[model samples]
Target: MSDIFEYAPAPESRDVVDIRPSYGLFVNGEWIDSLGDERHKTLNPATEEALAEFSYATPADVDRAVDAARKAYDSVWGRMPGRERAKYLFRIARIVQERARELAVLESLDNGKPIRESRDVDLPLVAAHFFYYAGWADKLRHAGLGEDPRPLGVAAQIIPWNFPLLMLAWKIAPALACGNTVVLKPAETTPLTALAFAEICRQADLPPGVVNIVTGAGETGQALAGHEGVDKVAFTGSTEVGRLIARSVAGTRKKLTLELGGKAANIVFDDAALDQAVEGIVNGIFFNQGHVCCAGSRLLVQESVEDELLAALKRRLATLRLGDPLDKNTDIGAVNSAAQLDRIRELSDAGEAEGAQRWSPPCALPDKGFWFPPTLFTGVAQSHRIAREEIFGPVLSVLTFRTPAEAVEKANNTPYGLSAGVWTEKGSRILWMADRLRAGVVWANTFNKFDPTSPFGGYKESGYGREGGRHGLEAYLDV
Candidate 1:
């Protein structure tokens, strides 16, 4: 809640999306009622308003979707040449670009992320994943995977709610490009954009059953991931759920890839530009309200400049805006849901109980929906729960290190190794730290930077397999 930069309430219009009272499951390329009676309403976490009710997919519904995907794989997608499949992926990407504003607005309303992020970050990245994969569809042979890499029959893809459409594109684009049919399940809280994407699949005249979306909670995802018919399973969410999915697919022919949780360390040395490092620190843990799986939640500053860096970081965080997600001026928005908010609060409170000093800027929060002020914890130790765990919110835990050796040791101490950041002016120092760091992705002067062409995933408990670049095609293809 930063009041340093005050602006008018420039809220983005939500009329771009036509929300239906109820949404049926998207299976076999069409909307259909779920066989089960379970129903849940998707909410606008910013206002706690009901956006729409969505049917939860039963085991039977999962079977129907798996059957459709299998049918499409055998009859259409699998047999089609990569070049022919590329055309469909291209169409989807183009349509997403054309409807970018609508999707951005809908994304903000449903996911409670700032409209600026949904529009500039999420929507563009969503389209980029498709566009990037569309170009790769006809070039898989040159991808160095294999001469004739074949699609892995049916793919069961379950994406997280934080970046719904983007994660959908991350899973679906590469799967389709590699000649596989997919049965996707968007996260329960943010299903509107994925449902809209099902319409986009229709608009592209994609063959029936080629791309299917079944919306529900964990149970529906469980049914789909555990189904016997799917040849590939891809998921992006919590580490605990990733473990369950990994176990479910074990001892089976199903190929699996998981992008799970992280407690990334953003290291800043004394030689780093203080002003630049401050901004990077803010972007590292505060981006997406720190809902990112690979967020740099642990700040490992050089002991020499810890005081200077902390002061600058605190000042920058105080200028960040927090309020209505639809407001074009807002920086931080609502937490995704009450459950996630509770988790953030529980962990943050534990940080205090464990003796870490907590600080927040003076700002009034809206009373309507889920909200947490951007928080900072100093005097943090590696053993502290806040430093060890993934808070997955706008909370930063600061810890200092003495040397390069100590920095690497501290950064790699966590069970998660999704990403890490190094902020030093020396190129040699950056290269030195990057080589020693255990993280899958290492940023030198930046934080939270993503590109469609770069391969990304993590080591150990953070999950396995890459999700972008030529390496991404490997997950959906059989070598």
Candidate 2:
């Protein structure tokens, strides 16, 4: 046998999933044809093959979805007791766990993420989000938001392509737990999981019109977010789009919460464990092919251990296998789409043009799919586009700092402040850095860690409001 670490193809079976040839809007707890004839193909990013064709919801469709949600809110879901809602949430969680493998396979096929990640990380977290919120369903009075927290009526939720199912759970579970009806729109590129989730809702025997899913591109999302019938609007995507949503809902009575972009900093001190820090740094940026909104794309290292860390990190990156997303052994997967890959290339090219040294290991990419190597940029200045902007790809920009103050200063320098990571053996220094960092979520000695019980959002341009825990309930509730 070859070396244990040597990559052998162990592709997951796709036979478990049955992708429908065509899909439609899930409105009033039923799949219905779109009002408009506009349709788009949902592609398998790993193979560039069209998996299925799905509808693009027109303005009328959005109105229908919003109206359905409104009716559900006023008639059934909104008036339902928290205990009854919890039963549906719990049932959904159980069904998701039972269908976990199917969802994982579909997610990898559709979203172009490694099977290891979708199976282990995304699906588990998706179930956990539902389970977590289920526990909070009947306990709103003690949630500290208010003595009697009421549902916010119809909520308009739009999720990104990166973590489709998990983001859906994040938006839906809390809204349902708080007894609010929702009309959700998944990203144009990755709507399969969301549509599957609508099936889950049906399976769970959720009330009609309680949850509506309309799949489409930007214009459909704009219609949903700007719908006057929506009592609250929540979105997870680009900051530019977040700003537009903020502007669109500015004067409306709608309560809006956004979880947008991030250019997070992962700071490693000289005193940190070199091996541990190296793993953390790699995971921070390269996990999910660095498509995460809060990915630690910026590595701020202490000047003393920069060389040592760089050498170790480079060696680790060389071992990473990038190929079929369905391959269980693959570490890096394809970029989500041609357009996203193009954006990554444009920004990476800009990094090289602006004087940063870019390096990639010997990654033999697949011929057909959208692929980008696990890239690293040393000598990356703070002003460089790679350092300042969210590449949202498998790219890490390395910069150096001298002390805790300097690390905090450099880490907080970006317009995005969603999260920051610190790796240091010294407890006091980690505490100090966490206190000083301007990001919403700061991880000490760990990166990209999330729990449904903990509230997550960001500061400034990273967008406002929290999405998990009891705080997440506040967004969907009227105190």
Candidate 3:
């Protein structure tokens, strides 16, 4: 009775969102049909209901988009004053803020993340990203690149489904602010927000072909990335795909930036605040259902306090509510797709088969849509598959270390260097670990916090090139 009383269905009203039956591709500032007859259905991952059908971009469609972008770059946007360009971005940001509720509700409906997260985390950040980059539009001359850095002619950007709007903002905002026209391909599963963003672009009265969205799966991305007219290629997706893009553009004049996967380690020392550390651990791997590229999937704890930390973590996990994504109180939501859910299961099963002990809190999952429980595997070795691979799900692998040196060694053992977290009472030790950790973003006593002004990316296999701040502008500029 108490458990039932703890959470009641407080679902957000879906009436706020008005989804269309079919959405055409947004190219050259117009809603145009794809050249291909093939159409993909976008479904609600939480309900497995069809949200909308989107046409897949063919090679010809990609060519058309590139041509439009090139025309815009050569004729209008490329020659526009920086201050004028700034106004367009500012308008888009204001429109995003104005339509925040609709976008948030639609995002949750389409992406299967909790409404609270879509509304509170993704939507706000999307708007903030545009606002942040808008200010940089006119200030590019002072960005320290050189005197009067010029825009790369056109950027072909490919983003994944986990963060549709936010990733779009990250890629498109900086490129547009730098005066580059864009041909962007949104992931097939989450193209609605990108198309809606296209509408926002129209509302801003952005120059035609300045920002075009070509929707499709991997093939469309390949067509866009390999397109000869593109001057730059920026991608945020799997490392496998990123490597493919890198190879596709080899010897070409295209400037490339790839933000790929991560297997971050969250280290908690014995002297740290135990309760707060537990919360950070929860937020690290479970936030966004652990779909984050920089998710702290690896937990490295000082052996002396491992027992206490695990106990507290399990207690906290038990209280997490999992249900309808639109439910305001739901903490965990559906996995983004059935394919992603399968990947999470396969990796987790490998953990158990490889001698790690798997545990999940007792919770009933919805029967209708894709779902995965918040899971943890203890007694994991460095050699375990779960420890090394990017599961990209709500799963964590715990490893214990006796010394700070051992902790650092275990943390840096992975090929990915995207993000890491360190928790300790001693400030000096935090600095030491942070300095040694090879990841791009290091959070001390915190996890999964983001800001538009901060640079975010990875080192090594996690991929090169930062995505935010002034460093992001370098990718789109010709210095």
Best by lDDT: 3
TM-score for each prediction?
A: 0.98, 0.99, 0.99
**Tens digit of lDDT per residue, candidate 2, span 208-301?**
9999999999999999998888999999999999999999999889999999999999999999998999999989999999999999999999
Global lDDT scores for all candidate models: 0.93, 0.94, 0.95
Candidate 2: list runs displaced more than 4 Å: 1-5
Q: What's the alpha carbon RMSD for model 3?
A: 1.0
Model 3 lDDT vs. the true structure? 0.95
Worst lDDT 10-window in candidate 2 = 1-10
RMSD of each: 1.7, 1.0, 1.0
Candidate 1 local lDDT, 1-479, one digit each (tens): 97655587998887888989999988888899999999999999999999999999899999999999989889989999888998999899999999999999999999999999999999889889999999999998899998888888999999999999999999999999999999999999999999999999999999999999898889999999999999999999999999999999999999999999999999999999989988898988888899999898999999999988888887888788999999999999999999999999999999999999999987689999999999999999889999998889999999999999999999999999899999999999999999999999999999988999999999999999999998999999889
Spell out the clash pairs found in candidate 2: none
Q: What is the alpha-carbon lDDT for the whole of candidate 1?
A: 0.93
lDDT-based ranking, best first?
Answer: 3, 2, 1
Off by over 4 Å in 3: 1-5
